[model samples]
Target chain A: GDKVKQSPSALSLQEGTNSALRCNFSIAATTVQWFLQNPRGSLINLFYLVPGTKENGRLKSAFDSKESYSTLHIRDAQLEDSGTYFCAAEEGQGGRALIFGTGTTVSVSP
Target chain B: NAGVIQTPRHKVTGKGQEATLWCEPISGHSAVFWYRQTIVQGLEFLTYFRNQAPIDDSGMPKERFSAQMPNQSHSTLKIQSTQPQDSAVYLCASSLQGEDEQYFGPGTRLTVL
Candidate 1:
């Protein structure tokens, strides 16, 4: 089974609109990190959460370990938000590597 | 900070040739990781080193692929007998020791024809 599953494989948003991306983990993830991969193929770190929620500018993210799921909410989408959003989960502790989801491709336009 | 640095932003190689990719981790970061991304595979972990030591390499191919971090600042991923299947973007990331948040590099695109 896929350790991490991401929903809405593709998404489209209009400027000023809002959208949310999700990830469900089959593994017992202790930590989760969100990343935005731009068109240039560079991954920009977005959020790193243990539990609860975090808000940064127009982006907000929540991680619920009990439910084994996480969500990334984007408010007032802008063209720069167009990219692939990926969520990676780290199992257990101690220098372990992250297992990434397939990712959600997002496109924003005017 | 300059973040992580990767050499040969793009490389095109012939099949059966050798390809060497380089990575320079952020200063003071002890954990460095390698990953491969392709249209078909999305993202796959290759290996990771902590403090110049390989902690895990379970994701690396058993043959033809090797990664080494001889020092804390730089690491290398070498592919012997490269194949078209090796075409993908190789990404390097580093983080503070034992931290979950990893900052990624711009990635090195390898094309084997």
Candidate 2:
């Protein structure tokens, strides 16, 4: 079984709309990180959370360790947001490699 | 500050040849990680080093894949006897000692023919 799984393998949104992406962890994830892999193949870090929630501009992310799940909410989607969103979970603590989800492909159309 | 740096950016190797990928972690970071990404596999962890010491390599293929971090600033992933199946985008990442937030490099695309 996959240690990390993402829902809605692909999503299409209109500009100014809102959408949510999710990650479910089978491992005992201690922290979660969200990244957007742009069309150019560079991964831009979006959020790094250890429980609770974090908001950055139009992006908000929440990580619930107890439930072993995380959510990334995008408000007012823009064309630049069209890319692959990946959620990675780190098990235990320091020096551990992250287990990445399959990722959700997002396409924001004008 | 510059994020993680992966060298070559792209590489082409014939089957049975060898290929080496390089990664320069962010300054002051103590942990370095390596991953391989493909359309079929998504992203898979290969190995990781903390302060130049290998912590885990459970995800690495036992046969021809190897990784080394000789110093705090740089690490390398070497693939001996490369095969077409070994082609993928190799990514390097780094994070602080106790923090789980990792910064990634642009990645090196390895193509085996």
Model 1 clash pairs are none
Candidate 2 chain B has its poorest 10 consecutive residues by lDDT at: B93-102
Q: Model 2 off-target regions past 4 Å?
A: none
Model 2 reaches what TM-score against the true structure? Answer: 0.98
> Residue B23 deviation, candidate 2, in Å?
0.5
TM-scores of chain A in all candidate models? 0.97, 0.98
Separate DockQ for every predicted complex: 0.82, 0.74
The residue-by-residue lDDT of candidate 2 on B86-109, one tens digit each, is 999999999888356899999999
True contacts kept of 2: 0.76
C-alpha RMSD by candidate, in order: 0.8, 0.9
Candidate 2 local lDDT, residue B28: 95
Q: Candidate 2 lDDT, tens digit per residue, A39-77?
A: 889999999998899999999999999999999999999
